[model samples]
Target: MAEVKLHGFWSSPFSCRVIWALKLKGVEYEYIEEDLLNKSELLLKYNPIYKKIPVLVHDGKPIAESLVILEYIEETWPENPLLPRDLYDRAMARFWIQYGATKCADAIGALYVASEEEKEKAAKEILEVLKILEDQALGDKKFFGGDNINLVDISYGPCAYWLPALAEAVGVKVLEPSTLPKLHAWAKNFIEVPVIKENIPEHDKMTAYSRSAREKLGKN
Candidate 1:
């Protein structure tokens, strides 16, 4: 029997990325919940470089980073292919996923912890980023991978869940249907997927945690 283990934090989008990929591939593995506040010895040992969660340990080897782990999962378990078979399509998916990680990810942090005076600017920045995604990356596709969810979709999983939750917690919205009709609709569809819907952190709990984190950041 193949031994697979995943160490993750429930509230982390990066962690969710790995979770979604595993679920989609129908791979059963052990899940170890980490306390980000008090890091576990195994987590530290497994990921000494980053000491981060979402580490996928197969047998005795540990793979760190959400995206890296995702790729590993796709390659290892080829049942439900998260990445495309065509070379060009796979390259395109990687490009967009990198764009999302570099561009969209930080914008989320800025919006989430934006002070009252900075909120408008942060929201505007987020809107611009979302616009790029909608117009260029997403276009009119139901999902990033057309009909079925792909690695690109999983890569941007945070936008489906955390983006809206952070917007609500911050009392400003950047993904309204009127402004980003297609992306907004896509978000709804992304969340409705059985695997995604089942795996995400609860909305109310996330909101409360986000609000608390924002407050803590304000004090520091």
Candidate 2:
């Protein structure tokens, strides 16, 4: 087996996604925790463009971006497939992952720092997104990928863990059971997966971090 090393931060959902994928594949790896504020020389060397966490180094080759690294993992270690076998389902999964990448940040940013009225507006927008996700993507499935959690669920890991903390910090609710029950249930089920449940940051710690992040957003 080739040597695998993961560069990540514990609190980052992006990092957690990579961790979950690696664990699911039963890949053995050395984990290097990077301080986002200081950024290690190895992380700088590996991901020069993004200078980001969650870089996967396999046999001295570096792969960056959580989603890109996920594809690489799936392709490299094909034992436990993270994507569908059918070509079109794989494409759809990628589409939803990309969609989450583009829209999720915007939806979360609304509550990151906003006036009371702004929170209301952002909550509504987030609900709309969740509604679309529940109806079109997740539906009644336990995960986005029917019975199994796949790339789409991994892509939205932040929504599962981070968004609730953010919403709590900002005093807004987006993933309510009443409005978006499927998505709400999906988030619950996603986090409860043994690997995910074990690896996620503690909720109180996340809430504290969310508060700090929101404060920084307010300043900027």
Candidate 3:
């Protein structure tokens, strides 16, 4: 059995982030496809707290949370360095990653669950968040890490693929080319990377899933 085992769901951006990091690091691991509704015994054993997918089990020791798992991967591999070498640069990278985890995620999640009357307001909030990301974090860089992708890029992986899919499903335009050209272009470039392009969930499937999820949210 492989020492590195990953339990993940197909349509999950969190899972995709780990997948991308592992692939970039050239790590060989066993992948266990998890059903969120009927989670596996091992997954529950591994992550008793959250019982979430994207758990990275290395030699029977499990690491829960995608960001924590990502840091673990970077440290263990040490090849294809995801973080910058400079102290300041690395700190900045972490800062943006943290921002994505908090502010960006909250805004996007709000938009996802927004009612018809609140959709526009939710979208505006997300746009404001993205604008900051574009201006402060991204700027004219091809990727957040600049030239090539780093932890910041990986951290914001959902914004590249899942956000667009979510926007389509919700019938709201959040990352528009006309309005936020740089961030829009960044999304396009991020997805086009061979590693990302190959690993991401299908857009149509994601949209359908998002739409279904919204319907379920409405009922509850």
Better of 2 and 3 by TM-score: 3
lDDT of each: 0.90, 0.88, 0.92
TM-score of 3: 0.98
- Please give, for residues 1-220, the per-residue lDDT of candidate 3 as tens digits: 8999999999988999999999999999999999999999999999999989889999889999999999999999999999999999999999999999999989999999999888889999999999999999999999998899999999898888888888888889888998899999988999999998999998899989999999999911
Q: Which residue runs of candidate 3 sit more than 4 Å off their true CA positions?
A: none
Point out the worst 10-residue segment of candidate 2 by lDDT.
211-220
Compose the digit string of candidate 1's lDDT tens values, residues 1-220.
5599999998999999999999999998999999999999999999999999889999989999998998899899999788889999899899999988888888878888789888889999989988998899899899999999999999997788787778877888888899999999999999999999999999999988888888888811
Q: Per the 3 Å backbone cut-off, how many clashing residue pairs does candidate 1 have?
A: 0
In model 1, residue pairs whose N, Cα or C atoms come closer than 3 Å (at least 3 residues apart or on different chains), thus clashing, are: none
How far is 40's C-alpha from truth in model 1 (Å)?
0.7
Give candidate 3's root-mean-square deviation (CA, Å). Answer: 1.1
Q: Score candidate 2 by TM-score against the native.
A: 0.95
